[model samples]
Target: MSDAFSPPPSPGGEVSADQRQMALFSHLSSLSGLIIPLGNILGPLILWLVKKDTMPFVEDQAKEALNFNITLGIIGIVLTIITVVTFGIGAVLTVPLGILLGIAWLVLTIMAGLKANEGQYYRYPFALRLIK
Candidate 1:
């Protein structure tokens, strides 16, 4: 045996796959509130700053969740601005846009969450991947 002690690898490497899967799920739980428009991005965004290197899968999922929430929030905010600037013309279009975006956000978030919960890596379509 080696004379000096060595710390074990991160959970993804050292723990059983089941434990790794649970870690991913716990990370997702921290993001549960993010499904609600602005709330959807807040938790994940904050968590990303703190947990990225601690776990790769969690980092990926959290980043995706944050991106998804931020995107939705931006679109909603922009649509609001457009509605105000265009004197209600933008408002007319905002409804349909909101509907489509909302549905897409919900589906994507749920899919991401469920997959993570199921112990699989969930990748979002059109998500900007910050971690390799």
Candidate 2:
């Protein structure tokens, strides 16, 4: 049994402070979607690719972040298509639903970052396991 004072263990042995920070960044990077097109996917992808060789913890967190963001992006695209195709009628439904999902994404991503910062493996409850 582990004591409460001990830090959480990561899958890849002892996680360094740098690794934890990178992992946290991996999860938080998804928020960049608000500024750059496809940034949600690209941010994690870049981080994962750049650090996967050296930081296993970061790789794990980045993959989770990437997959979750990808799933959210797909859902968002579908909602947008529905709204456009229905000529604003779908907005009555899709808009509110989209907003809710957006909030969920933000909340969940923040939670994941906190977990990663604590040296814990965080998995998205709804993310598709498309990356691995």
The candidate maximizing lDDT is 2
lDDT of 1 at 81: 91
Could you report the Cα RMSD, in angstroms, for every candidate shown? Answer: 9.0, 5.2
Candidate 2 clashing pairs? none
- Count of backbone clashes for each model? 1, 0
Superposition error at 4 for model 2 (Å): 27
lDDT of 1 by residue, 41-77 (tens): 5667666666676656566667666765665666788
- lDDT tens digits, residue span 2-93, model 2: 64234336464678999999999999998899899888899999999999998888888898899899889889999999999999899999
My TM-score estimates for the predictions, one after another, are 0.67, 0.87
Model 1 residue 69 lDDT score:
63
In terms of TM-score, the best-performing candidate is: 2
Query: Residue 105 of candidate 1: its Cα lDDT?
Result: 70
